[model samples]
Target chain A: MTQPTARSGDRFLAAQPRGTGVQSANLADLLERVLDKGIVIAGDIRVNLLDIELLTIKIRLLIASVDRAREMGIDWWEHDPSLSSGKRGLALENRRLRERIGELEAGRTGRRTQSPDADYEDDETPPARPRRTRSTP
Target chain B: MTTPDLTWLYAVARDVEDGALDGLTGVADEPLRTLTVTGLALVVGSVPRSGFDERALQRRLADLQWLEAAVRAHHRVIAELARTGRTLPLRFATLYRDDRGAAAFLRGAGPRLRAALERVADRAEWGVKAYLAGAAPAPADIAAPADRPGTAYLLRRRAQRDALAQRFDEAMAAAREIHAALAALADRAAEHPLQSAEASGRAEPMLLNGAYLVDRERVADFGAAATELGRRFSGVRLELTGPWPPYSFADIGPEVPETVDPAGTGTAETAEADVEADVEAEAGFGADAGPDAATGAAPRIKPPEPRSPEQPAAAEGG
Candidate 1:
């Protein structure tokens, strides 16, 4: 690794586009764009052997801001849990489950309450008749 | 067969003066030059085909030493050209067979690229990160009651867990507040996903990773807002780095152009073709896309200057 430049800390600031106290970029700053924003031009640089792609160098490049990305309609992270909060999806599912469970419980209790005679009939009918053996003794 | 020489695409700028790129060098220390394509000017350098071959470059990316050199050099060219005008930085190591291919690629995407450049015109990117310096102090460390050792131990553990969760919640709230305050100071903002401790290389947990697009004139104001937030949330280690190349804001619009190769492969190639398709760069600090993550000390934050609005202007070029 190279020894630290005298003012390595403010190197980016020193490289500011103008003398207006703008700062320079570090690796972290650079990667934030390289990874997320920017134009992703997919260049086709394939090295083939016997019709088989021995080496396929696809330059999947993307460098852009959130708005431009949105303008370009390339927002995959909004739905990706690892890259986004994704709380809306989870909340929606939770609400749906709670509503479903509430409806099921309501149906179960309503059926029981509305059919008291059915239960009574079941109990009464079971004991009303005496059992007869196939072989009468 | 002799290896074909490849042209490394560093960045594309609109209306950049040809003289602006004089003496600038790119990957492999080659002299940087511009290849005009329609209205776009691509900043590029010549490199050996063998050096940038897919298989060889994949192996090279794993070698930190080589990766660091390449990335630093690649970044230097982009950063330098960004100063010249509205530059659209290409992905690191974007190798083309020659200038003709690069030109065609740029020519095809001329309108999209122009739109991206215009969006970033007069704006610069600023990064704000909030980190939890350490675990919130334990609420209490009293020993378990002697009479109910087993139950007391469980209760004590639960308390500790609850306290930690509460602290985390408080930190996140502070992070959000900081981001909001900074966002208000800029024209646009976006929150990046939190990086893991392993990726950040800082034991302190990262609360927020955000980028802001500030008009060039308001950079000083943005810095002031950041400084004020840093003061307001002293408990959290807040870092405001940049005036960068609009990295977070420079995408080529939402419309996927037909010219781009549909089968674009990600950077993470496996040892054997079937390697886990993890596009995540290395899990270290510094640099995006990972393998060359540097272990450098975090940028130092100077003591806040006096609160006079004119201080920032006065400090310009200092």
Candidate 2:
């Protein structure tokens, strides 16, 4: 199985499939395929008095049963940061954190207590008064 | 009287002596008995009654689970058959009320069924799935250029997408070359898969989805060609499976209906199409086109074999 470059077994195996994809199989492809494809028999599971809900249920049962596929499902949503995989939420959360840090930094620049950024502020503004004098009498 | 549930029917070699298949079982854990016709074993079954009504059976097929059980049972036996020798498979969901029914059909099927089975004797089927890998680069969201506003940015992004799209088409071009080389070794094949919804949902693009029915003796050359392609495209994945039954080769033609099952995508469609096509190519393929033989498993339309394999490749590419 080794090529001239002698890549790892994982790489070779990965390349052995019908190679097509932005990346290797994603949750959607894996879920779509493993659940539906392969040599299936026409069974009662395929027949109900009603509608397409069985397909949905089949997916739910299938997703829940496959431990890693489900775990990967969560990862794709969180880590991939795409519209489907929940990446938008991650991006918003990041932006929100950045804003909060900016607000806190602005507050620190002009607090009544010790000003951590006081020295860095080259522009002078008038001081109100001394804090200790008001406390004495 | 009642077998309670549907049982499976299996196809074994006509020459597989009765004692040779002694321990074999059909669907319901029953002893396997061959359905012989003109001294040939047409089928073996686990059915209870000596007969069944076809009209009722068609209605019964609506149950997917029953269908699945029967297919799984059929597949189990077919797989075992492969371990021993070549077998022309019956279409999925084929049933006989009992051995007597199976035998009756075999006897009635006559020369047509015999010729079909013999045509596939000493041969096997192998599956090759070739998908075009990311013919496209990663999606790009280029920042708005300082130079333009209204339509320019949209145009650039569109241009980027189109450029990436061509990459797969190019990969497909090469894959077809490989497919052509492989097809030459086989006696016959199913339709070439073209639909790509799965690959579209995928990160990469799929180029081909195909199956081949070749003589048993040439499996090595087939694998070698595949392995060579694997090496050449070490960049591509060339998924291969089976030496399984002539699931692709068993051809009675499309009398049975097949609903649009899109999962297997292009490959399944082509395989489905090939079932019809191979039959049109020749009759008495070995003689017995078993009862459901003309059903969904065989090719419907047969085209003249090209004077040479190179011509089809040239035609497709051209």
Candidate 3:
């Protein structure tokens, strides 16, 4: 355990818990590694008769965390939104919105609308901001 | 009472004390045992085949109660062993046909298993997540001039968009800086994808999900640095958890020779895994794959073993 230290000026010394059980493992912590690391001992329990395979339940297990999974290059969760931060969702949304705006701008150029608001829109002197392709930096 | 049960494997250890696991039990209150092969010790317990059969296993896995109980049991054993000595934990529900099969497998994998154990010796993993605190209530700006309503509206919209972008950049910058500081303290570190709002249950977005493998001796120092980072960036709330088994750093030992595609030609399969995380919502079987909910704990879709004729029909899990 790290003792709480005094902050000197702008430098804030981080506080540490007086007591922490480092040995304990939570469900998330344990599940993180079970699939992407270690020895996967494979065995099959088969029940068969008359030269035909009836049921073959193959048991293959490896323990690993997300980091361990990535070390082995098994990083499917990075692109998966449900299991990850919603950056992927945000990226998709931004892309779709940009496309829609592009389409709208293109259509506006093809036909002059008689709407009264058109003059006000034209007087708007600002150039459109360049589209930002990245949702998360 | 005939128990044509198989051995439910938990973990493999290298230097546990003699009888360190004495009096310990496993899932369903079954007796736990230790089997040693080539100086590597395997921790296992008997799980009746009646409940563990493929059909029954799938059904039980779908039940959160059953899954949680089993995982708790499995983790309890690994945690105890890890506390005592170096251990390599197995995925939930790793089972063998019998003790003889387990022994043979251990013997065959002896070299790789030993290497894996060595890699994790005296090392533990720590989790650090950084979240952006909800943006200061949008800096309540009621100072808009009533005379210029249209200009004010557009200006307000523009300001909101700019503020949003600026906040994101600040959060990302804070996350990167914190991760770098923590990484310096740790022997090795990894950045995991962030958890979603539903999973985290926090309105502020998660900016960083990082795991560090710190030496047991320097854990305190690492923790202190993490705490300092949290304090330094008041805008982002940093969460530090664990000194857990080296779960995120244990892939250095063994290579599944057959599936070892350095080229990562498994794009099709990974896409399938992506779809699996999507279907998890409708499947209701690990639907709450959020970390808070039992690690969103469920078995991942294992690619079909070449030799096995039967595979799980449905692929659902994180």
Candidate 4:
């Protein structure tokens, strides 16, 4: 598979054969391992705990923005069963309730569209949200 | 007044030959140097205090660009050293006032560091992450009866959701089975927190984020086992990365107080004895040896013997 976002480091290491101990060039892979793993030794210079927490939050935002750009139109969460099961079910339930409310409103007003039921058929499709892809540094 | 340069310690290892780091540069493009103490080589670099001092580092770490460059540089140096011998990679941004300070740390932490080096010797870490394959299975097309479109739509949606929930359960089961199989083949295994879709840069939900510490000779077998597991479980895709510098396995216990004097002192000697006793205790209980001891930790599975002469060397270095 071609990696469109492969950095120069990845391209350089790609020439090496598999199982040759090449480090991954993926930024996320690097950050996760480097920041989280490794032995902790106290240094003469004291790094504040608050500063580390702030740095972690910043890194998370940076990763989120980068991914948002790369996967502009793909909202995996909407269809992800593991992640959205409860939320998606609730959304479906709410939409059905709203359709019922619309039917009642139309009946009371006596001003119904020719095929109110047919108009609501498209509710099976997920609603499209505006996609925002912010450029990351 | 210009502040003195701080010593940035990258990693610790034994028997790092002379000139092993001849051309290597570390974070801040400083020349790499080895400060040998207690029979361990401390791979280090000199970074300007102006940039690396605690206050400056906290600010610089927030800048993504600077963080990336410095991180990559740090890994590059450690990776190079790892090629030469077993290395205990230190956490990023571990710095000291000078060589003397770094030496003080090594002296205080000597026995623990040595045991860590022994634990990781002739072994490398491999990362295996499993992701659910393919886009969410397109909602199955169960034809809704034409007569009552509204009822049919609702039924169809419910069926689709049900099927998805079932698939999610199956996928999770597959992840656990895969981890068990791989863990059986490794000396040590670690389950890191799963990365978010944003962090993984993949649309698929990550199922397993695992690191395995495999003997150098078994690197090939471990990779093959992962590949076979991927094939057997068609729904999950496995990404195998490394022979990494044993970052996940580099825990050398908590920091020793800097007040402990260099090797000759009573406090340092007593600390060293305590570390030796701890190491012996760990060795006695093979299953409980590592920090990330997996459940049902099998006695260290010896890799199948008979590796090609070139394989070990190739797996050790790029």
Clashes of each: 29, 51, 11, 0
Task: Flag the better candidate by TM-score, 2 or 3.
Answer: 3
lDDT by residue (A25-71, candidate 1, tens digit) is 33334444554345555654432111000000000001012333355
Stretches of candidate 3 above 4 Å error?
A: A1-41, A45-137, B1-3, B134-146, B252-318
What is the DockQ score of candidate 2, to 2 decimals?
Answer: 0.02
Top candidate on TM-score is 4
Ranking of all candidate structures by their lDDT, best first: 4, 1, 3, 2
Model 3 C-alpha RMSD to native: 20.3
Better lDDT candidate (1, 3): 1
Instruction: Give the better candidate number (3 or 4) by TM-score.
Output: 4
* TM-score of B-chain for each predicted structure, in order: 0.72, 0.64, 0.74, 0.80
Evaluation by lDDT, superior candidate among 1 and 4? 4
What are the per-residue Cα lDDT tens digits for candidate 4 across B187-240?
A: 878877666443454546677878888887776666667766776776677776
- The CAPRI-style docking tier of model 4 reads incorrect
Ten consecutive residues with minimal summed lDDT in candidate 2 chain B? B271-280
What ranges in model 1 sit over 4 Å off? A1-32, A35-37, A46-137, B1-3, B134-157, B254-318
What ranges in model 4 sit over 4 Å off?
A: A1-23, A48-137, B1-3, B135-144, B256-265, B269-318
**Residues forming the 10-long window of minimal summed lDDT in candidate 3 chain B:** B276-285
What's the best-to-worst order under TM-score?
Answer: 4, 3, 1, 2
Per-residue lDDT over B1-318 for candidate 2, one digit per residue giving the tens place of the 0 to 100 score: 455434445664555544656666655556665554445555455554322234444434334333333444655565566556556555444554444445544443433445556666777655565554422355455566667864655655565546544554455556666667777887765533232322122223445545566776776677777777766764355655455566655554332223333564443213123222221123423432322223323322221122222234664442
Each model's chain A TM-score: 0.20, 0.26, 0.21, 0.24
Please report how far candidate 1 places residue A132 from its true position, in Å. 82
